[model samples]
Target: MEIRPIVTDEDHAAALREIDRLWGVEPGTPGGDRFDVLVTLVQAYEERRWPMPKLDPVEHIIGHMDLTGRTQADLAKLLGSRSRASEVLNRKRALTVEMIHKLQSEWGIPAELLIRPYKLDAA
Candidate 1:
């Protein structure tokens, strides 16, 4: 197998095409080995070329709410109460450690994502 570091966009594109071509190849086979190596190379290249920016906690929460078609009330339920939810959503209160834990546990959001400093306007 001819393998190389994915350096250029062309290299990345070729790796992607190879991955597609070898998609669903069973493990322990020649094609599968090629697929695995290509995926690793592609991942490394993408990480360098397109580093992911950390999402703001509030924005992330809002986005999840939108994507899931959840209402403020639903968020309130996840947060334990309506007033607390309102306070959080309105930026009247910062997320406390306990609240962050709760969000991570109940909503499946990463606590680290929720632990970042964020602006909270006065109530």
Candidate 2:
């Protein structure tokens, strides 16, 4: 396929096929250069057409716990109070800056993800 801007789904599909054909192409070669440009164009088109949703801080914490074999009790221990942990996990309380710092420093959760605004329970 001729190199061009990926504007439509057809263009995206064609680029993907070209990328597949160019897979494992040797770097610093003409085919490799085409592969790189097509990959970048496809990525930009996908991001502009279908942006990812923001990460939910609470769900992220829960997912981390699940992945690490941690539990609510562990979260309670980290947060220094069972009720506080519950409130935060249940979305009844928002995470404070202190909590964000603690999670980042202790659990290696990125402060950026934790700092994003998330919905809380009304009641």
Candidate 3:
């Protein structure tokens, strides 16, 4: 295995293509070990080169809604009222600690993701 630290985007892309070719190889085989190592290297390089933004709380809520077939009304029930749901969804109002706790407990979303500061709309 010609394993090396992936430093550049070009290197990262090349590693990904090689991983695709090596996909489904047996775990204990030579190709599989190389594939695992390359994946780790690629992930490290990508994280260093293009770190992801902090999870937007609103996006998390919307994603959860889509995943569980939930609706705004459901959020309203969890939160309080339809208007309150709208306000929160629309970023017109800030989420309270109580609301965060309720969301975490009820929806099983991580509190860390839900409590991160996110952009709010201008009033």
Candidate 4:
């Protein structure tokens, strides 16, 4: 079985096709081994060439609110102030480290996502 690093888009496409062919192959067989290798190669290529962008912090908060049926009041309670929640949601103020800690601990929002660099409004 000949296999190579997935470098270009064409190589990636080829690997996907091979994966499709290998999809039903039984494990502990040659086809299954090839499938495993090809999947690994394709994943590495995609991660290098088309990595997912980090979530925007404010957008992440808003999306989490929508997903979890949370409201501004919930955020205020988490952050310890309605005004602080408003400013944070409006992108007018930066989130303090403490706020990040609380949001992660209490609300289960990931600290890494919450800690991304975000712009604050001009004074």
Among all candidates shown, the one with the greatest lDDT = 2
The per-model lDDT (C-alpha) reads 0.87, 0.94, 0.91, 0.88
Model 2 residue pairs with clashes: none
RMSD of each: 2.1, 2.9, 2.9, 3.5
Give the TM-scores of the predictions, in the order they appear.
Answer: 0.82, 0.71, 0.71, 0.65
lDDT of 1 by residue, 55-84 (tens): 778888898889878899998887789998
For residues 8-123, write the lDDT of model 4, one tens digit per residue.
89888888998998898988798888888888898999999999876778888998999999999999989888999999999898988998898788888899998889887775
> TM-score winner among the candidates?
1
Model 4 superposed RMSD (Cα): 3.5
Clashing pairs in 1: none
Q: Write the per-residue lDDT of candidate 3 for residues 1-123, one digit (tens) a residue.
A: 367998777788889889999999999798888988999999899889999876699899999999999999999999989998999999999899999999999999899988888889987
Error of 3 at 116 (Å): 2.2
- The local distance difference test score of model 4 is 0.88
Clash count for each candidate, listed in order shown: 0, 0, 0, 0
Query: Where does candidate 4 clash, by residue pair?
Result: none
Question: Local error of candidate 3 at 69, Å?
Answer: 5.0
Better of 1 and 2 by TM-score: 1
